[model samples]
Target chain A: MNPASPAIDTESVTALLERGRTLATPVLRAAVDRLAPPMDTVAAYHFGWIDAEGNPSSGDSGKAVRPALALLSAEAAGAAPEVGIPGAVAVELVHNFSLLHDDLMDGDEQRRHRDTVWKVHGPAQAILVGDALFALANEILLELGTVDAGRATRRLTLATRKLIDGQAQDISYEHRERVTVEECLEMEGNKTGALLACAVSIGAVLGGADDRTADTLEKYGYHLGLAFQAVDDVLGIWGDPDATGKRPWSDLRQRKKSLPVVAALAAGGPASERLAQILAADAQKSETEIADFTEEEFASRAALIEEAGGREWTSQEARRQHATAIAALDEIEMPEKVRAQLVALADFVVVRER
Target chain B: MNPASPAIDTESVTALLERGRTLATPVLRAAVDRLAPPMDTVAAYHFGWIDAEGNPSSGDSGKAVRPALALLSAEAAGAAPEVGIPGAVAVELVHNFSLLHDDLMDGDEQRRHRDTVWKVHGPAQAILVGDALFALANEILLELGTVDAGRATRRLTLATRKLIDGQAQDISYEHRERVTVEECLEMEGNKTGALLACAVSIGAVLGGADDRTADTLEKYGYHLGLAFQAVDDVLGIWGDPDATGKRPWSDLRQRKKSLPVVAALAAGGPASERLAQILAADAQKSETEIADFTEEEFASRAALIEEAGGREWTSQEARRQHATAIAALDEIEMPEKVRAQLVALADFVVVRER
Candidate 1:
């Protein structure tokens, strides 16, 4: 709550995101359709546009946040949002591709209130479909036939490499008894920030923004991604299951080494010591023995995480990142309305209940 | 096998391939090392440079056939082989990426006489490393900083899509009672032909070849790929295990509906009927029952496949396609020495024992 900060109108940002999703859906669909049959069918299911049986579905794809950022960045860079449709489609495809692969790697059976692609189709198909979507993203970028294609492709490719690196680190962390907060943050930056930065900067590049402005927008996105992940960490323990479409205390149940958990463990308080003991004991248990945690046990673990100041530290960090993102926007000389939209989006990212 | 065709020089072509492998090895190793550790280790092991425990070991990495084709195509198109290093690197990376994923999907435990990546490093790391290599391929192409970056990326992306499509079809065919010979051929074209075509044409494009010449080179590659796959099918059935690094009748034991099997099924003879009966009987067996197939049964099955003229049809087709590949090269007006090299390479592809 800084008094000097600009007011964020969440309603307008929501509407803008809706518009971006509508604008990008057909383009994304066409790009996906270019894949071979079963893979295309599998991708369609992953996108929430169809059921596993090939029937139409009314399932929800998430907020289309990355594509919205791309279109909005294009607008902020002095071009019509239509000019950014290709960028928007590419980002959305990449996002879905990551989701498909991550679900398989993490052994997640469900996503967005539905069975995951791997669970429905199989791991082999999921991997292939993820790969196909990634290739389609590149295909869409090249087919855009713009002068910025090379720049856009290079940026996206680098981001993808970093994203894979982040996933690898995340998997490796699961095997360790402890992970430092700094390492966790670095992983989050690569896992989440790299793609979001690409999403924002790619639009600017395509919209003909100068180098300085593009870099500034990329910074804004990077910080925004950090803020988003921080809030997500808090929600993983405390958010309503109905809101998140996840089991209660999902991350805690899985002993995920997310930011808040790492922070709590590093705090060196009585609560932190108890939390570490609980985690170590759980780790030592066989898979059959570890499955018997009661609701009360989960609730107490969440309370301990908060008692260790993990919640406070994470909340403060999220606010800091949000503020930093908005400050970066101030460095970019864009139209006032577009700047307002960007600020609102940043605010929505950190402040959303879900 | 045609007497009127150019004489094949196997020794020189073998030496040229070895030279290409030496040049591309360091670059491929460096690019793969750029992946996150453990993933890098997995990739290195997959490339046969190290053992599973990360110790250096001598392991064969196939023929580096695709990279050699890329370099030779560059030479044929009037550029130094060095000019096509990036293209060679990219093709080789894509090839290895496919191998990694394919090993996982096919449940193949062994490759190049060693444990497959998924078997040694786990499926998650194998998938991630495969993705990293694919991203690296795109990175190398863009880093080429050539005017052909977009074209090269597009060609590679399209080839990747077809490769996935072909694999999807291959998997789906396993569930079907019969697959047409033409359908089998088309799948082979997509699975194997597309990447080989990309390997040849990307080199020509990078070498500043005219569009017509590039198209001709692509055609040569396409036919060469079909011939190569046909020969591979033959080897899968009857090639010596000591030379092929696989069990004799490996494809038959797995009941793989490879081109020869499909052609035999379509031929509708007594041996074909008997082969079909054995396959159906095998399909009906439980896992434990299936595992009881004796070496004598495998031998009998291979004998039956030959009796159906499957082996003969596939061999004749391979030679015909090899001839077609040489004919396509005749349409390109390259220097005599380069033409001879290419013809030699194509002949060697069909004639290799392993």
Candidate 2:
């Protein structure tokens, strides 16, 4: 496919995302205010609207990637953007809920250049906030103004289950010493990819696309999720600190059994032995020591990933999935411009650095 | 008010619970198989179905309180008892899910007279089991065969939110030094009471009650829950370990601001000062010294509880709520014998030991 034109700039994406937040904020705030007062402060902290002392914090809240993808998919599939707003919010809430809990379970103290909600409010309060947001997400989904709220909720429920399953796998893998490459991919697919698939699928459903197209969009999202995870795995090991807001090679230091590392270990040889030694070391090593390995080392590791077909697997898989997603959008007979924007949006996921 | 007729034996409740379990076993087992395998061992252990080795263990599973309430309410509200089987399982799963997380968050290592899921499987696995159970609960709620699955789901979602809110309040109170009596009441109302309300509401819905009647049953269950909590508060400070399975005076030792303590403190007098002294002295006392307080001291504390109107107020509140709940059931036009059974169940909440 042709690369997105240079004219598609950050200003436009930011503007679009801001508009989405503007529309969604009131709806979500109203429901949350009515439903969960004790958790309100923590929820606000997660959204970056309030600081630790319950004061305002000024900045962009989050990337808003999931919500935008959801709304754009709906619009591209020919549904009016407004109709899909609830679904967009639902997906975003689910995404954020996952984020809130993930930080706690992963024992991560910081997120987006700030102390995580758990760090600020404690895990107990943070858990309530996450659980509240998830419930509110379902509430919003029920308000999708569709006759088939049941069907919509059923899908939402299934997506959430996938999310939890993915997280379970992600956490389980951390304690595993002999994880396989296949298992790592599956974990990423569940943890990182399932919600994205749910996002597009919800959009397609709300857009009134027929069954076949909706299924294809789901595939598109599932593979996009896989690709997104693969790229994220790469970044966890080698991403620039300024861009990622994380210590470089943090995953390696933690011995996170990410796809790339799992691939290297699964190849079975010297590279595997080196990987094992690093993982099994007596104490934590400095970042420099971990990152200072030879080009031979990096290449061998990368080679293992390549041989195991992670990179090619993710890219080719993404292309095929997006093709299906695009085909689904076409079948719905969406405006060409809307379809183009959706394509640009899907493609952006593969290349996002932060 | 009737002294829980000796005829309503544990064996009958167990038999009914067993039947419900048998009916819903396949869906529950399927969900268990699909969502978690590592947890399979842990969950079986928690349920007292298997030893640590994943082989069978010998014992009763649990009291099965929520499921029994669901089935009984369904029958009382006029659905064939069999019709609400799935609802019964759904409530049981949700109940157990809450227990798994509560154990981890509270750091309690025992549940159901067995090692808690978290204690056996660790926090991470316990978290996953909780997640899996939530998914399974929603999945089972969808199978209620109530024609409008969306409504059933909305009820479940709303109930889930209330449950989370209750939990949030409970945990937040642990860190606060001077929680009010009203706040304590609200916490139990949300946490323990909401699920009871849900069981009744779901039963009514399945049993062909209109929205008003269903809401009434829910309200009744809510009152029952409050009464249940009041009794539980009394037990926390005075419960026999052989019966309650809790450490003696656990709430007092933990400085738990239960209804009686909060009320006593809020009354503000000599007794309140004495409570403050006890709380302060409790901080430095050895276990033996803490236990060495005179029987007169215990009597004085009970008198303080009475003086603050905590005991009288809670009992009156329970009676009023029970009456309101019964009135709601009456408005629903439930059968007379069934209504008597419902009344019996509500009365059991405030009176039962195990």
Candidate 3:
């Protein structure tokens, strides 16, 4: 590979994501506008479209990665990117819907450098607004009155059920004393991979692509989601505080049994033993003790995980998943530009800093 | 109507409801069975098909009113009852979904003579299982692979959104000092009427009924819902505790701004003024004060509302809505037996004991 490819891919992916967001934003806004006052207002605040006082704000709304993949998937099926707007809008809505509920369930107060919906509007509003967005996603898709619209809606609903299953598993796992690596992967596959797989394939489904092409696209997306999550897990422990908008060792502070930690626990080493002891203490500590823990304590736990080869194992798994995601693209022929953009997005996901 | 009609209608409606439950139960169970463990178990418990220990128990599931409406609607549209199974399952799922969430949001511990979902499982499980049931409702509708399936899905989604809006409004109203009569009715229309409206019409939609027929049937269900809610409000204040399984003046105990209370507040007179003062005192009291208040105190408030004509007005309104609901059937052609069953169900709703 050429040495300059990283710079070129970064620029290309940024343009692609921006273009996808540009196309999908109006459509998303239109559907959200269909909601009544308080729900619409809360949704607007959650989406970074407004402040707590209902004034317009320019806050960040994430990377638009899922939307970009949706648009490109439509293009991959030899349709205009416009064909994927419903897919884009549906996914973004579902993504934010999950974020809203998960935040409340996780007891999080801040997100995107602002107070969360529950913190600002209250938990009831958060639940209702999240439900409203989910209903809107289906309303938008089924209104198309086409066979493809029906199929796409079905796919999205199944993915959403799987997503809920993943959350249930995640919550249950947190309370248990031990979680296997296989169990963790199964949960993440359902939680993260299912929705992304639907996002990428739903566009092709809407574009009237055959089952084989949609299936291949889903493979690409499923692997991409795993890779993205692996990177997120690594960042959760060691990412720069400024870039991530989180405290140092945020995941450890929350007692998250993320992929890296699960893998380290499975490795069976001296460092793994030490890490388990710290985690056992974490599990037994009261709320006050957990809150009183210092960064150095978390850092030492992070260091133990690294010594156990967890960081390396997780990084290699991300690269492996990334390679598999790119390989799925080779199974089907598509426009060269679309292929390039998909590849660029995959690279960006695997290597993103935050 | 003939002198013998009430007895015959009561027996016939009982037979019809039993039939609808028998038909829809397997389909509902199958859809719920598709959910993963814990969620599936929680849903089963919510349906009264199982006990808290996961053992099968004959707990009371509501009367399955929505399912009966869907089946009758399909018969009204000249289709076999089997064609409406999807509609029956979807509405039942959605109804229970709302119940699960509402129980949590309302902070009620008891429902249908047993512990609520949140009381049985934690709040997080309540939230997740409720979410899963909602998703399952859509999945059941869209899997039928027909044009009517698409239309029915669209209708159900809109109704779900309205139901959520009603829940949001209900929560907000609980904190406010006063709620207008019209506001209370509007909220009930969305919360209770919208889903019932969809339940009655969705089956006909699945059977390819015309828009006029669907709309008229919706009118029937909407009015029936109001009648049902009015009866409910009346029972909340004055029903027999042994039959209703609730204390006398239960609505007042919870500070509910139900239809009777709102109407009583709106009527201007000495009794109305006294009722308002009592309500004002009730709202300002602490939890301990509320719990310590004697039954006679609540009984006095009830007496004031009755003297202000709130009880009589609500009963008259129930009759009016019941008449309106039965009248809607005249606008469309249907079998005589189907129409009779529909009328019977409407009568049952307005006069149910619990």
Candidate 4:
């Protein structure tokens, strides 16, 4: 490696993330604990802090990527990370709330290598706990008592609305035979991009950044979110199950209208045609028929997707988004250290294996 | 019946309620319409503005009671009703969100003489649309762009949390063998009173009422909410199905631990013991056994509750709460005409047949 390549300081970024998570997790847990019990219990279980029986459990809480972004963005906007703590907590709460409900809606049985909230506690409890967490996010923000509390709330609310709309669109796409790549991208933007953008912009607003700087930071986060999701889509299909914590080819097996699948369908090559035939056959099968489908059949379909250039296109899209995100960061005139950290975060988001 | 007595002007109160509902329904519908389809379709159906197939319908939208309370509180706090429009819309949206989720949770098939959103649209859609409406409520409140928006959002968030807690407790009670009247009332306060109190207090806050007046008005709504729930419990068991639009003896059939039933169990008469035996027998029975339990059996249990003085106790409690509600209003020092209308609204709440 060159002595000075301008690459992200991976060690420093990791330390910053760890520090932010350590500070934010307890505040997030405390907010969840404030909920009325049974709900508190369900929320704790969802956050991997407790078992379903309300006993303590050493379980995995997903890497606090959103909270880290919020804290980092605050520092980039010229304030201490502490000034962004409330924003960090709010983003984490909203993220978990979406996960809890999304798991129930999608009938996902496992997440983060454990039984999901709905699988362990039932759908009603999951729904209620999700609601409690969403309300808790707003409550924590209002308790900030800062001048930007209202603006922060408005931002979160709008993002939440878009998030719901995006999920709704994703669900609707499942019933359609064809979905455009543009429509798929719009859905991804709403489902993932809105919240990430809100997280960074909220931190900037809380840290007293001017409107232009905050807006630029939001653009950076938005493109980063898109790049992050594109990479996630890649990992969803081809990444090792042990690393991704998902079933191998789960999106393909579920016939989800993910980015690669949509792009493959749009590619219209011979391989794309064969891939469409396989998916349609899978869709028409009964439960027993689907159960009888061999892993070899799944492998061939994945091969067809790659041969059709879907995987290549998705990787290229991720890199394109990553480049755009970095360009947006150039519009904001922050300190050199902060700019490097931001660029490193963007790079990590697009390039991570899982 | 005395002409000289200062009885409530029910006619004027009804006119005020109709006016409030008329003004607020469009805003509420517009908000629901803003949701993406089929969520928009599901929301419209839930609002009783259309059929499941998207055709227009003349269905009941409940009494619009909460919105009326908001607008009236604004007027009583020395502002025009239009000043409370946002508050009214927020309360109504929250109320509908709860209804949507509660119907799904409770597995109720019918509401307001029509099928529920969950029954027609499925639970996932119902849950999503309910979530959308909830987010929309916060969005509308924040859109007010007033100095009081943050405070209003806080009040609504707290009330919504309590409301969810109360519902969680209500579901938990269904699994328990016995519940105390005090516990039941506390649950009722959280479930019903919190939102009502929020409605009145929010209207006062928006109308620029001073703290003492707003506090007093909240107290008034809180007591009124208790009275309203007590009355609803009575009607749940004894009101005409044609009038109430619920199954005959619905609460008794479901073995709900409503206020009257709890009070009767606490009363500890032979009738109470007999009623407990019947419910226990029903609970222990198989599905087929319960199905064979006849309508005559349900009526006999209702008779047993009356013979135990439960119905009489509930009615007396309703009157007691009604008096306390009126007394709270007396401390507010509002105009004579407005106070009369407030009292009338309280009277209508406690004395309504449906």
A254: Cα error in model 4, Å: 1.5
lDDT of 2 by residue, A219-332 (tens): 767776776777677777667767776665556555678866776666666656665665655125564675676656555555555555545554554455445554555555
- The worst-scoring run of ten residues by lDDT in candidate 4 chain A lies at A1-10
- Summarize candidate 4's per-residue lDDT along B145-217 as a digit string, tens digits: 6657777788888889988999999999988888999999999999998899888878778887877887788
- Which ranges of candidate 2 are over 4 A from the true structure? A2-19, A35-38, A143-147, A266-277, A280-335, B1-30, B58-60, B143-147, B266-273, B280-320
Winner by DockQ: 3
Cα error, candidate 3, residue A317 (Å): 1.1
A-chain TM-score, model 3: 0.97
Isolated chain A: TM-score per model? 0.96, 0.82, 0.97, 0.95
Of all native A–B interface contacts, model 1 reproduces a fraction of 0.67
Minimum summed lDDT over a 10-residue window in model 1 chain A is located at A1-10
Q: lDDT by residue for model 4 over A1-354, one digit each (tens)?
A: 121223656787687679778889889888888988788888888888887778899788876778888888788888888878899899888888889889988888888888999899888898889988898999999877555877788888898998999989988898888899999999999999999988888887888787788789888888888988998998888878898888888787677888998899899979999998888877777756755668897788889989988898888888888888888988878888878777878777776777
| Model 2 residue A109 lDDT score | 72
lDDT-based ranking = 3, 1, 4, 2
Best by lDDT: 3
True contacts recovered per prediction: 0.67, 0.53, 0.67, 0.65
Give the per-residue lDDT digits (tens) of candidate 1, residues A1-354: 461343668779879889888899998988888777788789989989999889999788887888888888888889998878888898888778888889999988888888999899999899999988888888898876555776787788888998999999999999999999999999999999989988888888888887788789989999989998998999999998888877888888778898888999999979999999988888887655645788888899888889999998998889888888888988878889888888888878887778
Considering only N, C-alpha and C atoms within 3 Å, which residue pairs clash in candidate 3? none
